[model samples]
Target chain A: MLALHAPASGGARLTAVNVAAEAVGLVIGDRLADARARESELQCHPADLAADRAALRKLALWATRYTPTTALWADGEAPDGFFLEVEGSAHLFGGEDALARDLGERLRGFGLDPKVAIADTVGAAYAVSRYSLQRLVIVPPKGMRDAISPLPLAALRLPADDCATLFRLGFKRIADLIGKPRAPLTARFGALLPLRLDQALGHAGEAIRPQLPPPAYQARLRFAEPILLQEHLIVATTALLEKLAPELERDGVALRKIGLRFFRVDGGVQSLTLGLASASRDARHITALVRLRLERLAEGLDAGFGFDTAVLDGLAVESVKTAQPGLAVQARALTEAEHRARLVDVLSQRLGAASVRHLSPRASHLPEEAATPLPALHGAPPAWLPPPRRGPRPPFLLPRAEPAEVMAGVPDHPPAQFRWRGVVHRVAAAEGPERIAAEWWKRPETPSTRDYYVVEDDAGRRFWLYRDGLYREAHPPKWFVHGLLP
Target chain B: MAPSLRPAAPPPLPLARTPTEALVNLRQTIARLEGRPVAEAAVPVLRFGCPEIDDHLPGGGIAPGSVNDIVPVGYDATPAALGFALALLAASQGPAALVQSRRLEAELGQPYGPGLQDAGIDPARLLVVSADSEADAQWAVEECLTAAALSFVVGLLGAPLSPTVGRRFSLAAQNAGHPLVLLHPHDTAGSNTADTRWLVATAPAARDRFGALGDPRWTVTLQRNRNGRTGQWILESGHGPHRFRVVETLADRPLPAPATIRRRR
Candidate 1:
């Protein structure tokens, strides 16, 4: 026999009792001393509220597989219990009764005894699931009134003191308070009496917000015993992916990002996310991607006792349709491009999203300002103009110009001889200075002007050099090698 | 999924006296016999309208699905190589990709969208991705080459590529029928396997009526040609409707600025 003790007015009281303790007439809320007096051999363990709350939260998140909308039924209202609004989702498991059976069977695997009920109203469902002798009562739509009529007045979800007050008025059953007028009930027991009753009867709407947005596609697997091997995890992942493929296909969408969650037996969760450069729904590709990511983090993903649950979710999705081919010979398989995209997806998974990029040109006159580098999956490519009809822009522009020493003929002439970065170059043929001034309004610090010259050395190597500021203004303007022309 | 059936190829026809008229007749007959529409043969090459530039390139222009290299010859040739890369990207069909490392992007002044747009490469069609290192950039390029969505991919490598990496990129590009142009500084061109390697250098800029700088120009020297003879051309852009033109003269001869004088106090 096991008993959970919590601090109470009478020192400590039994908050919960196992079946053996219950069989011996040890009801909950009884003082610990009284329970000991009744059954001297009973074992009592101090209740850990924090641990219990954490366990409940984990269970709530796990229930998201059955329905996206899952929430705690408010503290004290349903201790260690949650609400899963499985309105349109019950069919996935056959029906509400089947879903309840499956849920109970799976939860029992986790060593939990769960009470599940399906009703049109949350209040009625809560009351019936907890008090019904069957442990599973599914109330059909519009049947909430009769379904909860036999339950005690306490089943209305009211505070304990208020339920006792109603009981004192000879209203022991919920049916007894149903016939009474609302005004008299409020005048005596308060407005909550009728309001709670109305809520349970499905006459008023109750809001239950989801913890997060529901995944477009999701599948979950539970283990009777925790498994630790990476191979076993991969097997489980493949099975879940197979289950999820049909759902994605039905929606005519492919997943861009998939997330895997491992629920360890020690109450810790390990989540890994895999992103694809292109949308895909292929089970083999998805499984491969998962393996690639897992391989990178295998050592760190400690199975700590082992994982009891594995959940796979399609975190991001994009619409995809089969491409039609013009010729049958080429249509038998993916075109070269589609094949390439799939390869990119595989490589991206292994290398990371930062590896794949697209180069876009921006509208700026400054040599370095002319192009924008963007992440492949993020922003759209910018609009393009026709190729320019001018001197070729350097393939690469140094972030900053490197200083150089130069000897030139007369004032502001192209460098006749120069030394840059420890190398001396003799000028063969040089072009004139193309003056480009700083945008003073934008950058006040660079009020100096730049005189750029395209100079080719005797070795056939061309360099874009600039003398910063005028010679008269700064003694001798500093010369810099800004770029190397191929 | 099972593939839809393809109509069989048309039977071979006899040679005709008038080739052009016979070709038209054969195409119409093939279309009629297939009972389905047939598309025109895809062009294997892209011609840059300018004769001087086209005359030097194999097949008279750029190959649609091949690897090319643009190596900067000197200090300021990086921007020229980047410009030529963008110009090729602009001319290529479909979306393009640019893969470089963060260090390279920083060293080259992260390409500004406005500048790239002005250079003629549509900013919208470009997807730029920065890798953690130079090796990663090459790997990214190889991966991006496999994606059929991109018409081409451009990789900026600061160092020479190992034979394995170069071969991998070349094979991937060829298999995917996608072009890849690697940009490397001249000094680092070691054991490159690209079909063509152009040494790009900044040439003299063209002058407008007011003597201001006009369209940019580059002296593109074909350093390595696998299928054609080596040659050099001075390519200019932004003149009239023709976006590119090869000029014969090396210098624009701009009027020199007046000499400055110092007044002693």
Candidate 2:
């Protein structure tokens, strides 16, 4: 939200001359004719709040690597800067001095001529930056006042005209106003001057209302016009995506899914969602993928005099390699397996990645010795663990539904006739006593041994059944449906 | 109404040598489709994990792509209704979705997320979904069970379940190859929705009296199993203390089934 203004000239003129006024005195505002005649050496241009605020927001996002709470306050003629209060929390990046250095370095890296100061109060820090004893100032609590004493009264955050009036009254430095009565000052000028003084001195609290709430990770972008048209919505959404894509990248995050919330000026909310085949950050590609889905949503949009805000949300954020390119081609070839995978991928977007999954086989010979389940957070199974090759498998795994009744021989003998699924099927064909023992290491005292059979009924249906325990035990072997046959 | 089954990918632990070879004999018995001859169809492999339990299950374990249903006994009375839930959920592939009634939150704690994590299943992957009533649980179960790739779909009903509902879930489990694990409080005195029901409670893994420093054990009473045997065994649940212990053996105590069964196998 910060807005940075250049000197009458741009960056090169910044150091050479503190030439702020001569340019403003030139032909930019209402007195263009008179200003032009007055200062022939003037170079004038309209302020670009749009680009400046954009830059500050980028810096704020980058600062998130510092703390989740970062806000930008830029709504005046002052050149853009951050209102970051790294007071108690400043030590995280190695105390105030180191945090200042880091913040300045990062802003510079982002192509902004940055200066930072950590003071007891934001007003004091702003004053230090405006007219300061040192760049990247860190005002330790005990000497915080000394840091701003020599600075001009305007640095106290007063209106330009009021500061001039205060100066004319012989208030040359902040020291001159220290013991002054507040009632008269408020009666004469606005309350802002005294309020700014209290704020600068750390008496009055100065809060920077952040763009987001505590730990609200979602980022938002707004449009200038009240946009009712879908095309305009698309354009604004694209801009937001462009901004969001990089922030997500820096965090090493990919978008498993994202939601776009359109907050209409009329107070209605509409959301559109996109689930990725894999998490990604490329704005152009995400926009393309999401826009197709958005087109289908035109019928659902309720404009209500147009939306003024657009919010892009990354609800499913899994850390990933930020520099990943698009994978639409990888989602190609259209094989049947690939098609099934796409179904799961879509399900993940709606229910989250952890909701969709597959099973892993456990090593055991017991007829019941089979598989375990794990959350399939990743989309494609890496080639490392190749899926089991299609093998001899039953058509229907019996509903471990209910244990069946059977009349059979010995503990391990295949059943001659078994009652399952409420129906009787005589065993026409059967296979041997394949024995499966328990994992004694896991379960020490439990009785073990599974006598399994691969049996065929008279009707050609195959059955997977087992008898619990051994035939030698006094308890008769129990009949259970383990799995089904094709 | 019955839920549909959907096939889902699960962890693929390497198969041991014995089961792989045994599958050769069972291959012709249970092919993927009867329309095709056994020689043409893939071998029907049923991997029943842990030889003991598979001892009673038909076909040994479940067919690789087949689904199953487990309804723990005394779920109605067990304070750790989530114990059976997490046991099954921990072993699932995609995610273990719990479509629960609101009452579960009060007993299991406000947020079921942490408890799920403590039980060894990652809460992030757990979809602790909510439904208004048993009908909703049935609907969600049906939806989850119908997918061809699903591993299991459990419907924890608040009320006693109907045989028709059980049949519906069975049909869905068959289609999707996804197993369903349902939990009902002690109030569920006369309903059955699973192949097996174990009266379960999470207990000290071992007698702390010996200063054992691990998790507790679970005492499970086998109320009913579709295979026609009833028994009680104790198992410790946690890695340290969770060895299941069979304090009382209703195991040898035989109980006649309410009605004679006619199995379709």
Candidate 3:
């Protein structure tokens, strides 16, 4: 009584059929009205194509247990199945037959009706799984020819129109095409006819682009016995880093970001990632940084049963030239820089990386635009010019300028007194108004020009206040307290 | 001198010691019981060039290896406290680290490099770390304090710390032999294990040749000191050979505005 129907060209077609509906002689793609004629009463629901596609993608990712390379296979325009390149991976599960049986059994346990086949090529696998009466089929090398010969011409992955043309021409089975001469077949059906046939017969190469590729710089340690002690885990991590560091050094590269993944015996994975301020190849430095991170993540990493495998991956790497000894002083300086870099690496890992920042100068005249904070490891050393001597800048600049009421004698002159945060401050002394024009190219919608002044209150608290807009404008200028002079 | 090989005869001792000798013996006995050196060479201090300011502190100046607590007296007092800490950092010998929380950074704004340079601490020698939370900032501060490479560590906190956490920081500073300064931006109250506690308020700025605001000044009050001294002084930053100096002519402090009283309707 339960089925999801979509209106097709002819009538209401069953897009999805539930177990109860299928048991009552209902099937997907069947005319709903005809199915209803068979069953006196039937329940109908609407099909959600977007949700179905997302579910299929999730299932494809889970299929990675069988093979690292899995892709969605499309029936017409919709993804109806998954293609797994279990080429050399089947042996881990004993053999191809056992792997296919395990896959089918596991999927069936999850309420999925599965039809699986293992073949040498994608075309043969797709054809036999969908149309063959046998639930499972395993075709050996050069076995696809006899395997797909008796099937309909649609099994060749041809379009419906081409299939009808082939039927009218008395070519109803794949065997009919296998015996025909290539020149005549192409002259009638174009190049695609022979290309698809060759692809099915393993004469042409077919590639399956995987969803994700394995990391290039990675070392894995598999233990015969699971380890639960923190000290043992640290020892295993050190060993893995030692194995991975030499490869990086050979390639003239250093890792700036790395990840440690722990595969638990119960099939759960816990990962910790660390970012460094500079490129480093020293294994001791990496181990120290990872140790500090482990201290912080002690609660989340539950070695449920125990961890059996540990993998270290160089998530991000930077190229560097090998160091050659220079002058004594230069060598000392380099050593100092290296020490600082290591300290920054450990600190960045201890505190979140975003918390450790380095200042980089930006090419702008605005006070706020002069410099910016970037992740300590990611930013290069900053080069800055000497500050202007006209007036002293504040020790701290407000994140956002707070509005203040300014009273002054002249429109362009510095304010005599200002009220900020509900307290009034009388200006004991005043400085010149340095004009700062807004970046019109960047923010043309509201162009504003500021007139800043270094004003000290009666209590000697200096303030950097600015008039937001010029007095020469049609509207009166607004005042704001921008920064504080130490 | 070669003939004086025999021990000299002891002079006739007085029947009783004088009052001054008795007092000296009593002081020595107390020092022994307290487990402190009676006259330990003044703890090595970083001297402010200005004699007046240096003399104000016991042992002549700030103890560079001790924990100094700075409490802001008002909302406008944070800059003063920071300027004072920076001056101390400028006088130290090694690279300095500043650990600040996001809340503190957002409220008081970040430490500007050029401004810090102008204040006399070389921008190149400073490492600024912004933590996500107060606890993270405290942890970073402790960790940096234990780093032998750091000259000193400055931590900015939104609130006061419990005595236990403060003791941990004090112990860490002692172990690393590096100075530590904790800045409490808001006027929060709590007991701390610092050698000295100061309350810094904004004072009048110095005047330039043209009578404009020249440099920042702060009214530093010694709220608590283990050396048994409580005093207040007006000090200027980025001045003198030590980068800070005491102002002789203390500005007149305006009396607090009278509290309003409402009559019963």
Top of the candidates by lDDT: 3
lDDT (Cα, tens digit) per residue for candidate 3, span A1-486: 788888888988998877888787788889988888887778877788778877877777556555657788765523567788888678877899999997788678667888888889888888878767787788877899999989988877788788899999999899998968899778888898898888888998777667546456887776889999888888988899888878998999998888777867555567787878788877777888877787778484799988877878787899988976566764324455666677678788878677777666677767887767777676444655666664556666778888999998667988998898899999988887888889888875987888888887887677888898877778898999877776
Q: What's model 1's overall lDDT?
A: 0.73
lDDT, each prediction: 0.73, 0.56, 0.76
Candidate 3, residue A46: lDDT? 74
Each model's TM-score? 0.61, 0.35, 0.79
Q: Is candidate 1 or candidate 2 better by lDDT?
A: 1
Q: Model 1: per-residue lDDT, tens digit, A1-486?
A: 999999977599998999999998999899999889889899999999889987888888767667767888785485768889998888876999899998888688778888888999889998898878886788988998889999998788898888887788788999898877788778877877788888899888788766656776788887889999888888999998888888888878988888888878655678888877668877877788778777756375888899988888898999998565466675356664555456555655655655554566555555655664554544233456665654444555666788899998657888999998788988866776877777787775756787888776664456778888887764777898877553
Q: Output the TM-score of candidate 2.
A: 0.35
Return the DockQ of model 2. Answer: 0.02
Which runs of model 1 end up more than 4 angstroms from their true locations? Answer: A1-55, A66-69, A75-79, A85-121, A128-154, A159-178, A187-191, A201-207, A212-486, B1-65, B73-76, B91-94, B185-187, B200-211, B214-221, B227-265
DockQ of each: 0.21, 0.02, 0.35
Q: Ranking by TM-score, best first?
A: 3, 1, 2
Each model's interface RMSD (Å)? 5.6, 16.9, 2.0
Best by DockQ: 3
Residue lDDT tens for model 2, A7-116: 44223122111236533532122343344355565444545657867866765654544444567765642646667756645676688888789767756654566667
